[model samples]
Target: MRHLMASAALAALVAGTAAAETPKDQLIVAFNMNNVLTMDPAAITGGEAVQILNNVYDALLQFDDEGRNLEPRLAEAWEIAPDNMSVTFHLRPDMEFASGNPVTAEDVAWSFKRTLTLNLAQASGLKSRGYSAENADEMFVAADPQTFVLNLPEPGDPKMILMYLTQAGIGSILDSKLVMEHDDGGDMGQGWLTNNSAGSGAFSLQQWRSNEYVLMTRNDEFWGEAPAMKRVLMRHLPESQSQRLGLEQGDLDVGLSLAASDLKALEADDDITVKTETSAGFYYLAASAADEKYANPKVREALRYLIDYKGINAAIMPYFGVERQRVVNSKAFGALSDPGYALDVDKAKALLAEAGYPDGFDTSIRVISTQEFLDSATAIQGTLAQAGINAEIITGDGGQIYGAMRAREFELLVGRGGGGQQPHPDSNLRALVYNPDNAQEAGLTNYQGWRTSFFDPELNGLIEEALVEPDQAKQTEMYETIQQMIDEKVIPIQPFSERVVTAAFQDNVQGLMVDPWTTRFEGVTKGE
Candidate 1:
């Protein structure tokens, strides 16, 4: 406590002294630096990277601030084949990159093909949807300088295809000329793009320091309306207390990832505005299907009842997230109402007994060391103990914990997954539940279905069926049925919260978006 006070005092002194040098047209944001793993859209992961890249890159389509409504961006309009197997994007003419290079269809094609060739974080999304690297060039054709065509070899909805492209990684367009000029070795400029940006958005990457800060300068040659801020600074402050202090002392213009307590406190402060918007992700507890301990459907169902959803949402997830049982976000189509099942330890014990573990069994729970996740896990642990279940908490960073889950090495994991990358129900369904083949040779390890080793041929068929269904009402009906099946069968994963990214910024800082997907420094201005 004493050390914190001293640090706070020093920060106040520094902030006061630095105020004179800082420009009113510049914004300084402090958030957890650890959230951004990479800037290269092809390799980017997590919301932090998505939020940063949204400002630095432009996509064919984007979600507007209020509605997750899809709107044309780089592409002025599009044409979808009657068969729904192909879609062509008509690029806006006279588009210019930060480097003043004219945006072309070839650049957009290369940007997408680059994602497939590199096979980084984004390849799986397209690959699963049926675009292969071997045929990428053929899949993406630059019909002309202002026209790009995307041909889907698989049987999937072109609407979903367009929706997937709305995300920062898969949907982002790049400047082919600028990126190729910096290509080192055969990495397709992966090394260069890791620190630099070759995009046509409102800003350009000025500098980035891992676990430190990233600075961006306005792009004078930007194709659209310029941002109010001349520069934006994002500092990596992992500790909530530090971020709160920074926001309070005017050392930071915006503070991200503050704890619930701090957010409540900030809500009372007249100088700060605490905004919470629904994020594209969820908090879930997954169990490996390969483990016999959870093999029985009854066991998985019991685990669901064991979770104290109300207690956790009220005590732990407030401001950060809210109770969300279904895998699909409430904001998506075909979303079901919450089952409204409260915690019942007796019911959980009975289910466990039916699964042949009346006394319950010892298990391990893996969770990231973040406050919300850790607290939720701890609360669940105590609840499980009440049902005679002994759960050992294994905590680590996101990579360490999620890596274990991805490798199919975890028994149980409490972590965040299921990005509603697109507003379509298929978007969330394909990610959290769809599994085609579970064989080791398939190498579909990136999917949450594979990570949890959860596979059901019937469920798989249902997902594919729903995707191809064209009738709006029919499509949603099939999706609702699929969701019902998942709930009844006790799928290996249970979601407790639909995460909402919260940030406290200066009351004077206007136009700061609370949604990570739509977040950008554009139009942001400070008061006098």
Candidate 2:
């Protein structure tokens, strides 16, 4: 039966439907990043790759178009325990995976457990940061095939539950049958489904030719509103100019992360509708707090003052400019009162002097080899020079640079941190700053190693308290206190700028929903 359904779905994909004739229209999106890795949603982590994989996989819970939490693709509804420690979800009985197997509570439980185990083994570096690993044991048991109960160690916060459920790491549900079948001689680590997908989602992957294109077709057995378009072709045009050219030539229906200059030209085009969202992320320089030379708070603060966010925003991202004072939505959790870090040359000089560098110290800034980052690095280099700091800018490919940052291999590095639609201060703090296991040795985001004796313990207590409070006002207050702590400590230099750029065909696309944290590409369709 499962094979029959899979065959039928493949047949439908082969028989492509015309966009003009169908109520739903197929969208061909071009992005700058190449899909070089596996399609298994659980294994991949890059933003662009995950965004593409989202269509092919269904998470247990997902946020809606408005950023309001919604029980969409999988679970029907969920209830939080009175103590706020546990959440029980009622599954949709009729839903089935693309493989024609029922999506039971066991599958959900197994998926969660598998991901948690994987995180412990493969992603220990990230798990230690309090992203998704700590809550594994809290998810107690699946009561039955359709109902599951998550038992928290304590009265866990509701926000933490929501954050964890929606996080990309634990979001993708897996099929136990498929997973077990793919295991090599019962070795769970060698599961075939690790690289392939067999879950319930709007679209199923049909063909993928690395660095070229990946094609997905609508799942006819999809339990929800059947997609109008028959297929979605995700093209990998790694070069920015080629991606822009593809959009201009009508070879692509949408372009992700359109260059600022290219966006200006496309915005003027009557056919294309340009959209910008204030990303829940920020771009900043991480000076390794763990490194002896750069660990000094005074030195780190001096670097913050030397960053001319205003100049960088104007020169690099003129279209959707944002101030350095505001770190995107994710980091904005606790930061209500702005302990402002302005670009003050005199103040920066004084701080450097206090750090025993009467003569401004020389340091190297490592940045991604992309044109945009290079431009920002150049501007920052000049800005730091004005503050009597001599800094050289170094560039490398994205993979190399990302690895370098993770290893904390530089004196100073330009990077972006903070993610999620509605992130909590505790979430950001744990992931970016205080996670000692993942702390960068040189200029990674955790460069300052600014750990208060009370930081982690207080955060854990506050998180638990916030979960049970249920009062929005009190939650806000708790969050504000966390933000105050971050600001006072100066964990990471919070130079901010709007991060995402999206464009669609104005005549064809409608009901488009954009959020700072996540993009809902499912409901979008071509107009009649």
What are the per-model C-alpha RMSD values against the true structure? 5.4, 5.4
- Relative to the true structure, how large is the alpha-carbon lDDT of every model? 0.85, 0.63
TM-score of 1: 0.88
> Which pairs in model 1 have colliding backbones?
none
**Native-vs-model 1 lDDT?**
0.85
Tens digit per residue, CA lDDT, model 2, 404-482: 6666566777766554345555555444444433322323344223321112455445544554576668877876765
- Measured by TM-score, how close is model 2 to the native structure? 0.79
> How high is each candidate's TM-score?
0.88, 0.79
